[model samples]
Target chain A: MSRRILNLILGCASVCVGLTPMRAQEFKLFERTVQVHGFASQGFIYTNDNNWLTMNTSQGSAAFTDFGLNMSTQITDKFRIGAQGYDRDLGQLGQYHPSLDWAVADYRFKSWFGIRGGKVKTTLGLFTDTQDLDFLHQFALLPQSVYPTDLRDATLAHVGGDIYGNILLQHHLGDLAYTVYAGHRSDSKYSGYSYFLTKYGVTSSSFAGLQYGSDLRWSTPLKGLLIGASRMNEEITDNGNLSLGPGIDFTSYSAVSRADWTNQFYGEYVIRKLQVDSEYRRYLHDQIVSPDSLETISDVRGWYISGCYRITKRLALGSYYSRYSITSVAGGAAAPFFPDQTDTSLPANHVYDKVISGRVDLNKFWSAKVEGHFMNGYGNSSFPDGFYPLANPGGFKPNTNALVLKTSVNF
Target chain B: MKNLRLLPLVAFLVLLAPVRARAAQVKIIANPSVSTDAISGRELKSVFLEEKNSLSDGSHVEPVLLKSGPVHESFLRQYLSRTDDDLRNYYRVLVFTGRGSMPKELGSDAEVVAYVAGRKGAIGYVSAEAGVDGVKTLAITDGRSPVERRVITRIEPEYPETLKRLNIGGIVRLQVTIAPKGNVENVQLLGGNPILGESAVAAVKQWVYATAPSRTRIEVSVPFNPQP
Candidate 1:
C-alpha cells in the first residue's frame, strides 16, 4: 500500500507538469461572456473491519470517483445561464455515469432581487454549493454529519425554481441573503438508500415528493463572520424499505443552521492560508407507517468543527472533530422488522469521527491529499434503507480506523 | 520618391514607439454611448475590476484594458491597487467562483481607444497624448475630499527604459498631498521601481485642480508595461 501511494504521488506530479490545463483559457464566445470549467477526482479508501462507504472494507476499495464539467455564459450584465454535468461512483452507490447536476437560467433584476429557474442547487448550508468541488476543501471529505455523502442526490439539488435576494440593514452594518425554493428530488433506487431498503424486502419505494425550503444568511459588520439558517419540509412516501406486508409510508422535515468564519493571517499571493469552519445540522422525522396503525417521531442531530492551516504555499494541514447521534427514535415499533423501535439508546447508534488530513498542490490544477480517521463507535449504522453497511446486533460496540488517499484536478 | 518610401516606416514607428518605453501621458476615456462623464476614481476602479456593473449614476459600463503596457500597469496599480500577476490571479479566482469574468484585453492605446469609442458603455485608458478622436476623456483627481476640484487635463508618466528592457513590469505607487488651492504640494513614492517612480512623480507635480480649504492625500499607482 505504501508503495502504491508513493507511485501515485510520483505519477501525478509528472503528469501534472506536462498537463496543459484549461483553467486559464477563458475568453468571450461570440463577443459574449462565456466561461467553461471542469474537474475530476479519484480516491482510495482502506478501513479496518468497518463496512461503511463500501462492502468488505476490511481489505480496501478504490471505488470512489467524481467528475464534473460545467459552463456558464453571461448574456447580459444582469442575465446568466449555467449548467454542469456530474458523475460519481461511490462504492455501491451512484450511477457511475453522467447526469444533469444543475442547469439554471438566472436573472438578477437588481442587488435586492434575483430569480433562478430550472434545476437548482439546494440551499442547505455553506457547503451545499461547493461540496462536489473537491479542490475547494482541504479535507478528503467534508464532515459527514453535516454533509452525508450518501444523501448527495436526495439533498443535492431541486428540480424547480428559487427566488433569492439580498437585504441591506444600514444601521446594523450587515447584509442578509434570503432564498426560497420549491421542487422535488429523487432517491436513486440503485443507491445505498435503496440498497439498504431492498435488503429488508422493500422492492418498491418512492422517496420523491414536493419539498420546499428557505435559506437565510446574515453577514455581520465583522468582515469574515456570517450566520445562516436553512429550513426544509419534505413529504415523502416509502414502504419503510419493507415488503408488501402492509407497506409503510411517511413524511420528513429538516432544518439546518450554520456559521462560517474565514480569516487571512498569511499568504496573499494566491491562497488565503488559514480558515476555521463549523456547522450544526438537525433533522426531525415523523413517520405514520400504515396510516392509523403506527406513528413514529425522532430527532437526529450532528455538528462538526474543522480548522485548516497552510504550512507553505503548496502544503496544507487540516483536522476536524465530527459527532452524530440519533438523539431519539420512537414509534418505529409499528413498522415491520424494527427492533428497539421505542428507544434511541441502542449501541452502535452513534459515532464520533475524528480526522486528520494533509493536502499538497502538485501544480496549478492538480492536488493530492491523504486523510486518516479514528472512530470510537459504530454509530453510523443505518441498515434499513441507510447508506452505512453496519447492522449492529447484540448491541455490538465496535471501534474502527480508516485511511484514504485522493487526487484531483480541475480546469 | 525618396521620401515616400520612408513615410510608412516613420508612421509605424510613431505608433510602435508608444508601445515601447515612450509612454508618458494617459487619459481615461469612454465610449460615446456612456451617459456619465464624471465618475469618482473609486467607482471607475470598481467597474474595471468587474466588481460592479453600473456607475453611481445608474449607467452600465464595460471595461476594456490594454493587454500589456505602461498605462495599463499604472492604471491597475493606482486605481485597482493590485500587481499584474495579482490581478490575473484575482480574475482567475473570480472566474472559477462564478463571481466575475475577465475583462477584454486589447493590444495598444489606439486599439483600446477605438474600441472604447465604438462600443457602447465601454471605458478604457490610453496615453494622454494619444489622439482620442471619438471617445470622451473622463475627469479624475487625486482628491476625493472636499478640497481639490475635478481635474481638467492629466499628464501620463514616461516608461523607464531600463525597467522595460528588463521586463520588470508592475504598478508604481505614490502618495500625493494636494494643497488647499489645488497645487501639488508634495509627492512621495509608496511602491514600485525607483526609475519609474521618478517619472511618475515629475508628471504628477504639474497637475492642476480646483481649490478648497483643506489638503487631501491621494495614493496613486503608476504602472510600467514591458509586453507588446
Candidate 2:
C-alpha cells in the first residue's frame, strides 16, 4: 500500500522476530561508551465477575503488553544522557501507542547537588520508580489502590527539570534524599486525567496543566529501612463544555515506607527473603461547577501494606491488602457523571483489594508470575459503570475475583 | 566397613577443594585515575550498589564487571554479597529507574582489566593470577583510621525469620574500619554463609564506634542462633 504502511509492517515484523526468543543482549557502541537495553512483556487476565484493567477479561484475555527500548551514554564522570521509548497496550489505555517514557540529561555537580532536565520518571511511592518493571518484584501487578496503572501517564513522568541530592547523617539517623521538580504534567490521552474524563463520559477534555512537587526520603542506617514523604500540586485548565466546568486544582500527598530483610539461612545468593512495603496517599482536588456556582474540595485517601518472602532466589510469595475511600464529599464538584452520592447502586468511588501472588524468576532477564486478587471495590478506576463485563446478570456487582498471569523478559 | 570404604573419597574431596577455590581467586583493581590506594568493604559496596559514586577523596568512581566467570562469582559473593543474577537485576533497577546506568560489563578478566586501565575512575575485580601490568591493585584495608575504629555504639543483627524457623545457625565474621569521625566507615564480609553474612554486615555497618585521634580497624563476629 503506502510507504508508511510498509514501514509499520516491517517494524512489527522485526519486533515479532526479536520477541520469539525475547531477550536483549548488551549492545555496546563507540568503544562501549554507550549501552542499549530493552524489554517486552505479555499478560493474561481472568476475572470471575468484574474486569480489572480491561473488558472481557473474565474468560481470559491477553490484552496487556509492554515493550520498551532504552539507551544511555556516560559522556563524562559527572554527565550522562539517556532516553527510553515505550509502547503499552492495556486494553484501550495505551492501544500500543508509542510514547517517550523518559529522556534526561543529567549533571552531578557534587555529592550533595545534581540536576536532571527533560522527561523524568516521577512517582512518590516506595516502589513507584520500579513500577513499570514487572520482573523486579514478586507480583505481576503492584497494589493498584495506591499505585494505579490508569493514572501512570500523567503522574509517571515530568517534562521539566529536577534537582536532587543526598546528605549523610550520623549513626541511626541515616541519609536523606530530596528531589524537587517543577513543570507541566503530561496531557497525553493515556494520562490519568484523560482516563478520568473519558471513563466518566466527559466531552471536550483538555488536560493541559501545570504541576510541581518535592519528595524526601530518609534511608535509615538500619539496613533496609526507608521512609519518605512526597507532595505535588497541579492546576488543570479544563477547556471543557461538560463536566468539570473549567478550573481544577489537584494536590496529592503520600507517605511511603519500605524494608528488605534476608534470611540468614541458605546464605548468599539463595537466602530466604522477607520484604515489607507500604504507602498511604491523601488526595485533595479543587473542582468548580457553574449553574449552582458551587466550588468544593473532594478528599480521597488510600493505603496498602504488602509483604513478600523469597522461598528461594528464584521463587517468591507475597500478599497485600489495599483500600481506598472517598473520605469526604463536602461541597466540591464531584463531577456530574460519577457524582458524590453516599447512597447509589454504583457506590462509584470506593475500592478494596486483597491479593496473593507468586513469582518465579527463570533467570536474570526472564520471569513469570501468577497473582490472584479478591476485589470488593473499583475506586482505583475512573469509570462510573466500571470495567467489568456489562453482561452481568446481577446488574452491577461490587465484589469480584480476578487472576493475572504474566511473563516478562528484560535485558 | 561402609564408612571406611568412603574414607578415600572424603579425603579426595578435601584435598581437591583447594584447587577449586584457587580457580576462583579474585583481586580488586582500579584505574590509574583513582587516587585511593585502599577501600573498605562498606565503601566498596556503596560504590558498586550506586549508593555512593565517589571515593572518600571525592574522586569519581565507576564500577566495571566481568560478565560471568569463577572470579566474577567469587568477587560478588565476597564483596557485593549477591549472586550474578541478583547483581544483574540490581543493575536493571538502576537503569530502568533513571537513577543510574549499567556499568561496563566485560566478558573476561582481560577485557575488564583493559577497560579499567584505559578509563579514569574505573574499578573492577579479576582473577588474582590475571595479568594486570597497567591497572593498579588497591589493597582492601580493614583499618582505615585507627583512632575511629573503636566501637562505641553496637547494633545487633536481627535473625532472619526463615533462618530462625529452620534453626540455621552460624557466625558471620566482618572486618570493620571506623572513620576518624567515629561513624561506621567500612565493613568487609570475611567469612560466613552468604545470606547470614549479608545481614550481619548490614547491622555491623550501622554501629557507631568511639572516635580516637586516628582511625582503627576491628574484627567482628556476629552469631545467629535463635533461642527457644
Candidate 3:
C-alpha cells in the first residue's frame, strides 16, 4: 500500500499499454508501408554510498523508466518522413515529462546527398543521435564520460535542419560519411542542469541556445574500422534568479555564455563478434553570471574506451573504463563558496568510473542487463555527471560501488 | 600401404565436395519482366543492399529473401559476404533509420519461386536444384569483389555564390546510378546544403565510370571549398 509500490505499478502499466499497438512490425496504409516501432525500459539502481543522478539509490530505487514510440513511412522512393515521441522518469530528472524527440521530413536525392528538416536528431559523435535506440548497443548504459544520461535532452535533438550523406572514396581509401547541421536548442525545466542550478540558489526559468555542428566519419577499408571527428559551437543563456544570504533575498540573474564549444574524436572497430569503441571529448564553457558580477570558466575533458563481445547469440558481455574531469575551473567571485572549483587536484574535480555489464536477450524483442560500477570520484558539482550535492547532503565518499539492473522490450 | 594412403585422400575429397557444391548451390532467379538476362556480382549486392532499385535496362527490381535456410546461407556468404545474423541486423538498422524496408521473406524455395513468378520485378534466390520453372535464372558474371567498381571521370561541384561569400563550405553527398555502358543514368542528392547539393547533382550527372558488367550504384562526395 506504499506510494512507491503504487508508482512502480503505474509505470509498468503505462509501458504495457504503449506496447499493445506494436504487435505488427509494420502495416500498410494507403498501399504504402508504414512502420511502427517502440521501446520501453525500466531499471533498478542501488548504490553503496552517495546518491546518483538525483536518485535515492542508497536504499535502492526503481524510479528509472523510459519509453519511445515512433512511426515512419516512405512516401516516395526519395522522400521519407517519421516522428518519435519520448518520455522518461529518471529519479528526479526527466520527471515524466513527455517530449517530441524528433519529427523529420527527409528527402534523399542521391546516395551522397540528402536533406532533413524539422525537429531532427543532432549528429555529434558516433552515438549521440542513436543513443535513444538502446537495443542497438550491448551495454546497459553508455559511458557517462561521453554519453551522459543526465544531459540527454540537452543534446538529443534540435529544431532545425541537417544535411547528410555517404561517399565512397576512390582508390579503396574507404568510405566517408558527413553531416552538417544548424539548429536551436531548448532544454526542459526538469533537466539535470536545472536541478543542479537550484542548489546554488539559481532557479533557471529558461535555457535556450543556438547550436551548429559538423560531423565527418571515415569507414576505413579495414572492414569494420571507423574513425570520426565532430565540432560543435553553441551560444546559450540561462535566465534565473540568484539567492543571497539566508532568508528571502533573491535577485534576477542570468548566465550568459560568452563562448561555448565542444570538440570530439571517436573510433570504433568491430572484428567478428567483438566490438571496441573509444572517444575523447573536450567541452569549454565561458559564462558571465550577473547580479553577483561573477565570471566562471569550466573546461571539461572526458574519454572512455569500451569493448563488447557477443559470447553467444543471446548473451553479450561488455566493460568500459570512463574518465571525466574538470581540467580547469575559474570561479571568480564564487570561489569562496566552492573551494574545489579552484583546486583541480581534489577528488571533487573528476570522476573515474570502471563498469562491467552483462546482457541477455530473452527473445528477439526483449533483453535484460545487469551492470556494476566502481567509481573513484564524484566529479565537479557545477557540471552534473549524475552526482548532485542536494542528493548527497552528507558529503560524498572517495569511492562508491553501485549495481544496476534493467530490462528493455522493443518492437 | 599405398592403397591405405589413397583411401585417406579419397575420404578428404568426399568431405570437401559437399562444401564446394554448397558454395555454388544458390541461383539468382528473376521475374520475366526483368530486361537483363545476366547480373554481375556487384550489381546483385547493390540490389540486395537496397542501393540500386532498377537495372541498367530500365526495369525496376525488388529483392526477395528467404527467412532462413541453406540457400539463404549460401547466398549471403557468396554474394553479400555477410552472415544471416549480420544481414538481419543491417536490415533492422535500415528500417529503424527509415532508409529502407525489409524485403518480403518466404519460408521455402517453392514459395519464393511462386512469389517471384507472380510479381513483375521480384527477384529471389533458391537452391540450384529447386525447380525454377516459371522464373528465369540470371547468370552471374564478373564475380569479382563487390566493392571494386571505380569512377572513370570526376566533376567538381561549384560553390554557391552566396554561400561562398558567407564562407559556408562543406562536402555534399550524392548517390549516382550508372548504366552498364559506364554513363551516369541518374543522380540524387543524399545530403548537403540544398544549394550545394543542387550543384553537386548537376556536376555528378555528367561523370562516367568504368564499364561494369551491369548497372551499379555508387555514392560520391563533392566538396565546395570557399576561398578564405
Candidate 4:
C-alpha cells in the first residue's frame, strides 16, 4: 500500500508536528464526572482492478485498522454509566479481536422516560448509533451502501435492553426520539461473515442472533432538519462444517434464520457549513438450509445520497451515491445450495458506488481523508456489500477504481 | 445585458457585507439572582440550549460560555442558531450522548463578567461594550416573530392505515407548546413518519391558539396524502 501510505504519512507527520492542545478527558469519580474517550483509525486501500474487502486491494492494502475506547459517568441527575472497547484489522476483518463496544447502564427518567442495559448501541439508521464516532464523520467510508464496513459486526451492539425517550412537541411541533430495543446478537468468528464463509468450504462454528428493534427520531422544526426510522428483527443461527472434498471429510452445515427483517429510512439536513444525507435500507432474508431443508428467500436493497461541506476551518468536502441490491426470492429452492444466491442476471447481482471525499482538520483531534471510488458491481458474494469471492480468486470484474487513505484521532 | 443590470447591484453588495459583519452587539447578562429584567428570544434560546433550566420568572438557570469572542460570535449567531463548529458539535453530541455537560466556557467579556458575576444561577453574554458591573442586563425580546399566535383552532390528522397502505405520505412536523390559556400544552414530534408522528401528535393535542403574552412555541405541519 505504497509503503503503507508512506508509513502513514510519516506517522501523520510526526503526530501533526508534535501536537498539543487536546481535550476530552475528565475525572472525578465519586464526585462524578468521569468522561474519557478515545479513537484511532488508519486506512489505505488502492485498487484498479478487483480484490476489495478481503483486502489485497489489488496488491495495495495497508490492512486498515481501527481502535476505540470509552468511558462515561453521570451517576445522578438521572443516573448514567458507560463503556466501550473495540478494535479492528479489516483485511480479513476484525482479526485483531478486542470487542465489547458498549456497556450501557443508562437510566434517564425524564425528557420522556428512559432505561438501558448492558451492551446496547444499535439504533440502526443514520449512521447506526454514530458508527464508531469516527470523529463524527465527513466520510472516509460510510455508505458502502449504508454504512457497510464489512457489516461491522453485523449491527454492532446488543446484548439486551433499552427504552429511550425525548418527546416535547406541544405548539412548536418539533421533538421526538424513541428507541425500544431487545437483544443478543453475538457474531464474530472473526467476522466479515466468518471471512466470507471460507469461500464455500464453510466452517463457521456458530453465529447466534435474535435481535429486535425500533428507532424514531424527528427533530424537525425545519432548522437543521433530521428524520428517522428503523425497525429490525432477526433470528439467525449459522453453525458450521460442510467441506467433504479433498479433505478429511466435514459436513454438518446449518443456516436457520427465522424470517429476518430490517427497514431503515433516514434523512438529515444541516444548513450552515452545509450537510445532507439520506438512506434507505430493506433486508428480508428467510433462510432454512441444512442437510436438506432448503427454503431460502433473500431480498436486501440499499440506497444512499450524501453531501458534506464545511468548506474551511480546515477544509471538508464530500460526495456519495451508493446502491446495492440482492434478490433471489428462493431461487428455485435455493439455487442448488447458494452460489452467492446469484441470479439478478449478472453484474454479480449489484452494487453501484461513486464516491469522492476529502477532509482535513489536522487538529482539534486530527483527521485526514481522501477518498475516490467508482466501483460498479461485484455485490452478491454473500453480501458484505464489498465484493469478495474469497477476495476475488481471479474470476469476476466489471469495474473497479479505488483509492482511499484515511487517518483519524479523537480525544 | 449590462451585466444583467449589475446583477442586482452585485447581489446587494454581497448580501450587505455579511449583514454588516454579522451585527450582534451582544449583552444579556443576568444573575442578580435572575428574577428577570426581561428575557425571551425564546427564553434566550431555552437558556443557551440546555433546553430550559428555568426562567419565565421561576428563575434557575446557568448557561455561561464565551470561549471564542466577537461576543462569542455574536452570542452564537444571535441567540444560538449556532455555529462555532455548530456549538462544538453541539457539545460533542452532549458529551458523547450521556446527554449534557460541558458548559461554562469563559475567556473574556471580562471573563464573562467575571463568571456571570460570581455564578448564582449564572447566564451570560457581553460586549455591548462590556463592563456590566454586577450582572443583570437582560431585556431582549425578539420572539422570533410568528405574528403573535393566530390559528384559534385547527385539528386534522388521521392517516395511518399501515401508512396509508404503504404508499406512505409525508409532512408531519409538530412542536406545539401553547398554553397561556390556549391549550396544546405540549405535543413534540418535529419531523415526519413516526407513524405520521403519532398522527401528528394526536392532532396537535387538540389545537387552539391566540391568547399569548406568555407560553407559545408553535410550528405545525401535517400533510399525508397517498394520492387520492
For candidate 1, write residues A1-411 as lDDT tens digits.
553454355446534632655443466788875677777777787877556564345567666777776778888877778777887777667746578888888876655577888888877777766777777678888877777776676567888888887665555465677888888776666556566554444553556666678888876766446777887777655543244345545333221112111111111112245667778877666655553245545456668888888888689899999876664343444445443332334445666789999999776677789999887665543322122543322233367788888887776
Best by lDDT: 3
Worst 10 residues of 4 chain B by lDDT: B13-22
Residue range B1-228, candidate 3, lDDT tens digits: 865756664565445333343343577899999977667765687679876566656677879999887889978987887878678667765555545666778899999999999988888998765778799877564433342345678776676675675565555656677788889999887555667778889888888778867786655645566853
The lDDT ranking, best first, is 3, 4, 2, 1
Task: Give the per-residue lDDT of model 4 (tens digit) for B22-61.
Answer: 4545667877998766565656776687655555455667
Inter-residue clash pairs, candidate 1: A350-A379, B24-B156, B25-B128, B25-B156, B26-B128, B70-B225, B73-B223, B74-B223, B78-B221
DockQ class, candidate 4: incorrect
Tell me the tens digit of each residue's lDDT in model 3 across A1-411: 254674587557645644454343678999987888777787889999999978999999888888887888877756878887888888888877898888889886665678889998888888887676667777777888888888887687789998987775665676688899999998998888888898888889998899889999998979789999999888999998888657987889898888999999999998888989999998898888886667777888889999999999899999999998885444667657544475545678888999999998776666788999999888855687888898999988888898998877777
lDDT of each: 0.66, 0.68, 0.79, 0.74
| lDDT, model 3 | 0.79
lDDT winner, 3 or 4: 3
lDDT of 2 at A121: 81
| Per-model DockQ against the true two-chain complex | 0.14, 0.31, 0.13, 0.03
Q: How displaced is residue A6 in candidate 3, in Å?
A: 5.9
RMSD vs true structure, all candidates:
9.3, 11.3, 14.8, 24.5
lDDT (10s digit) by residue, model 1, range B108-224:
988998899888788899875567899987755442542334555568887766456556565555777777788888999765555677888999888875676778776555666
Query: Considering DockQ, where higher is better, how would the candidates rank from best to worst?
Result: 2, 1, 3, 4
Consecutive 10-residue window with the lowest summed lDDT within model 4 chain A: A9-18
